[model samples]
Target: MSFDRACRVNVGLREPNVAFEKEDWAVGVDRGRLLVIAEHVAPGVPAIAAAVRSAPDDKSAMTELAWGLRGAGLAAYIDWAEDPEDVQEALNSLRSRPGAMSWDWWDDEDCEDCDEAEVIERFLGLAGDHSRRYGAILFEIEQGGDGYLVGFMEEGSVGMLVDNRSLRVVATGWQNRA
Candidate 1:
């Protein structure tokens, strides 16, 4: 199991149309912004992350993850827009570096006994060699709160935290559990 320090949110309050003040996060994406994008995003590049984050596939968090990975010399999972519309421009920054490929398609054809930790070790090695981070945005549904959290690992250890109150984020971090 993964280490978890997740906290609860107050259920009675309404989620605000807020944006992350942190530079590491996507801008202009709160409740209202997401609603607007839900209608516009296509189905190709926005999948798993959308389900995890509660944001549409075209929203900021997933885009940022793709962008951040490519920008930092890592492989990008999606064939992002080269000159995306102003709204889609954020994803254009991360081009695949030389000798890089999106780790999403990692092959395990030769190792049936690889097990979970070995697979994670291999993924982490590749991510570290390329300076790429891995993470996911999961909604904390247990508390009946509309809070979304980023569970991530950038260059070192993993972490988990939620945006509380007015939806302001002080930081970000995630990786799928092995």
Candidate 2:
């Protein structure tokens, strides 16, 4: 919908309906980094909507959103949905449906996309491997603009970009206020 009114949730609250392990949150955070990069590099592009809607359901979308925030280096404040069960109910009918569902409307445009389960699985596998190796998650959200910035942060780090391969910081902070 309206990016201005786009809501955000953290990973420490109630877990979404879909099964989201710590690994899922790690990956979600990583994805968030990429969304942040897109916002900076492609001002009008709706990467967040695209990515979130691509999930199988609201729980999946929420998990994916958390990853997106983490990817953007804003991990500290991304709280899990307060009432994940409600979100689950909102998406129950659509969980195993066979069509793209509308997640939001952006400027009169409905944001709809089929959930890419395979792609998500691949990313999770990658993240899980990294998590096992370094005792933390290492992920890169690239916009391929001024520079390809790869953000490395502990799986549980707040919002600090521990390592940046390319561009410097722009806006860095936790989205949720605890």
Candidate 3:
């Protein structure tokens, strides 16, 4: 669906134009629909798995995860930009660090009003059911103390939440779920 249908305007921002405001970030509705404007960026599963094991919480794990995925493989070269010209610049920045996730544009530095524990709890609440129903594995990685990374691997999609500020899909593929 579109952002207009799936997103509730973030009250913290005066206008929603992707500006660098604390509240400009938005999350998809709990109903499991997302308003993704950019193309999907493939994530590094090996990196994601390693970060998950080392990071303290979901948010921190994502920061590390983004770094891993940024330089993973063929998919690492892709860039998501509003303008085509900006693609190279974004890709450059992404590659600059080599193995770190960027949580710079979070809505509220680690879910703002929501606590880490609470965010994890909520994700568990929603993801548990979703994972069970879809036969997918849903998880949250730390974007930092202020953000989270939530991910879901299903028959048709591979998604992750960066800093818990937003959810981005790296790959949209299907796997036979038994």
Scored by lDDT, model 2 comes in at 0.32
User: What would the TM-scores of all predictions be?
Assistant: 0.21, 0.22, 0.28
Off by over 4 Å in 3: 1-44, 73-83, 88-155, 158-178
Q: Give the TM-score of candidate 3.
A: 0.28
By TM-score, the candidates rank as 3, 2, 1
Model 2 TM-score on a 0 to 1 scale: 0.22
lDDT of 1 by residue, 1-178 (tens): 1223222231112443223444524433344333322221212335423442564543444454334333342322321122112211222233322223244434555335755444443433333333332332212111111222211122222122223221111111222221
Ranking by lDDT: 2, 3, 1
Q: Give the TM-score of candidate 1.
A: 0.21
Off by over 4 Å in 2: 1-45, 77-178
Q: What is the C-alpha lDDT profile of model 3 across 42-94, one tens digit per residue?
A: 33344445554566653344334455554452212221112222322333353
lDDT by residue (112-174, candidate 2, tens digit) is 341333223233233324332443432333221121122333334323322321112211111
Clashing pairs in 1: 135-174, 151-173, 151-174, 152-173, 152-174, 153-174
Every candidate's CA RMSD: 14.3, 19.0, 16.4
